[model samples]
Target: MKAIVITSPGGPEVLQLQDVEDPSIRDDEVLIQVAATALNRADVGQRLGSYPPPKGASPYPGLECSGTILAVGSSVHRWKPGDQVCALLSGGGYAEKVAVPEGQVLPVPEGVSLRDAGALPEVVCTVWSTVFMMSRLSPGESFLIHGGSSGIGTFAIQIAKHLGVRVFVTAGNEEKLAACKNLGADVCINYKTEDFVARIKEETGGKGGSTLMMLSSQLASVWYDISVWCFDAGVDVILDNVGGPYLQRNLDSLNIGGRLFLIGFVGGAVTEVNLAPLLIKRLTVQAAGLRSRSPENKAEIVKEVEKHVWPAIAAGKVKPVIYKSLPLSEAAEGHRLMESSIHIGKILLIP
Candidate 1:
């Protein structure tokens, strides 16, 4: 099998396509002949030597792929050879073939193409796991997602809309903001030019549902943030990827009892945050990495996604946002596009 190898962890130039030994499947796993794979921010992090694969996981950098089953392990009964599927992977998507646990594999949605299915697993699982399953973002609620033009953001906008939630998004420029808007984002703010906190405040911040209900501090007299109460309690949930730099800002953007889900730290990861808003507003903060999750956990997420999200795609309520497709040997170019952050959505590597 030919896979993209990181000759040495550094720039995109370090990624070299080479013939590698074929993957050996476990009893509960299946071998897939890759059709396509998608690029993710984590791939760049791994190439820079900051994020290494979990112990015993694939050494390559792809997190998701769409492929045809070549062989299924003895323990895997649900899938068979020739079945077309997409899978949430810990790594190894950047190859002609890779091994995956059967439970982590998903049948391609009725309306999505085989190649586009490669972009769905990671973003859909990540969004569903964090924003819906964990955060409990319900219908009629207002949700805000940062990086609205990125792969996750674009999908988040559509799914949120499909679920009858008001969506707010932040992008770096007008073009990205426009793309987000067309995808059903209600409020689009350019983080590069405006203060998102202030924008969110202006858009949804209203008389915060009786301030007394949100007060939890003994020093309640000093807890009055007029700006917060002047508008509303902000949004019901926030999905953030900017990490450390936007930590405090994310808390401020949420309503009382609001939930914040973090999946990445594209900006620097370390930052000093004021803990006041968290306590005052009763915010829930959580961060997770798909690659680090146990296979069983990923399976659970994959199951929930197929059950809850597949219909949305099949119904044409949600769609894959693909920016570009490159050959497997051009994996380096895919990384360069992702790192440049110029692309509005998922970039695929065709094998």
Candidate 2:
């Protein structure tokens, strides 16, 4: 099989496609002939030598893919050869074939094409696990997600709206923010121009200044003072990937009992923060990674996503956001595009 090999830890130019040994499946795994794979921030980090695949995982960089099942191990059930599926993988997606634990495979949703399915597993599983499953985000609650036009952010907005939450997002420009808006983001904040914290506070009307509290008695006053008094509220939950620089602001943006789920540290991993807001807001801060989780844990998340999220996709309420598709040999270009941050959503690599 052919795969993208990291010639060395350096730049995108180091990613070279070359012949490699074909993968063999374990007793509980399935071998998939890759149709498409997606670019993720972790893939770039892996290429740069900052992040490496976990032990026992494939050495290649891709973390998710969609393909047809070519063979299944003896212990595997529920799928067979020729079955079309997408999977969350630890590595090896930058190849023509990848062996994945059977539990991680997901049937392509009814309306999504097999190629587009490649973009779903990672962002969906990440958002579903962290925001809805872990944070317990409920309908009518207000939620804020940074990088609103990103792969994670675009999907998060649709699913959050599908579940009836009011969505808020922060992007770098008007084009990205407009894209986020069309996808159902209720409040769009351009982080480069607007103060997200102030925008969120104004829209949600903080714990101490909830507009709902005075809606009935002060309806007229609210209409008159909406602009002046609205900038104090906070959201019920926040989903953030940019860590460090966002820690203090994310904490300050939450409601009294808000939850903030962190899936990455794109903004740098360390920062000094005032811990007082944590106590004042009674906040819950959590950070997690999908690649390092055990197969059994990942299986649980895949099942929940199948049960809840698949329906939304099938019903046309949620859809895959693919920005571009490139040949697998051009994995380097995919990495370059992702790093440039000009694309609005997920980028794909076809094998």
Which candidate ranks first by lDDT, i.e. highest? 2
TM-score per model over all chains: 0.93, 0.93
Candidate 1 Cα errors over 4 Å, as ranges: 207-232
lDDT agreement with native, every candidate: 0.90, 0.91
Candidate 1 lDDT (Cα, 0 to 1): 0.90
Candidate 1: clashing pairs of residues: 205-231, 205-232, 206-231, 206-232
Give model 2's TM-score versus the native structure: 0.93
* Model 2 lDDT per residue over 97-143, tens place: 99999999999999999999999999999999999899999999999
Report the C-alpha displacement of residue 341, candidate 2, in angstroms: 0.3
Residue 289, model 2: Cα distance from true site in angstroms: 0.4
Task: Please give the lDDT score for candidate 2.
Answer: 0.91
**Which is the leading candidate under TM-score?**
1
Worst 10 residues of 1 by lDDT: 207-216
